[model samples]
Target: MLGWALTFAVLAIVAGFLGFMSLAGLAATVAKVLFVVFLVLLVASFVIRAVRGQSVL
Candidate 1:
């Protein structure tokens, strides 16, 4: 998921550089959403592991 976010972020940057405003905006939005989801999942996983008395790492 994080990888996907990074990919979209890069795509947004490239698209913006090429003056594709719509594409860049869409890609940026996707990247932001994916990044938020990734963070949520990561925190949830850590909490679950902690509750289970396991190492989060």
Candidate 2:
């Protein structure tokens, strides 16, 4: 999921550089959403692990 976010972020940057405004905007939006979701999941995972007395690091 995090990888997908990074992939889309790079795609957004490339698209923007190529002057594809609409495609770049869409890719950027997707990247933002996926990144947020990934962060949420990561935090949730850490919280769950902590509750289980496990090391998330």
Give the lowest summed-lDDT range of ten residues in model 2. Answer: 37-46
Q: Pick the candidate with the highest TM-score.
A: 1
Local error of candidate 1 at 2, Å? 0.6
Per-residue CA lDDT of candidate 2, range 1-57, in tens?
A: 999999999999999999999999999999999999999999999999999999999
Q: After superposition, how far is residue 13 of candidate 2 from its true place, in Å?
A: 0.6
Give stretches of model 2 more than 4 Å off: none
TM-score of each: 0.98, 0.96
State the C-alpha lDDT per candidate.
1.00, 0.99
Runs of candidate 1 with Cα error greater than 4 angstroms are none
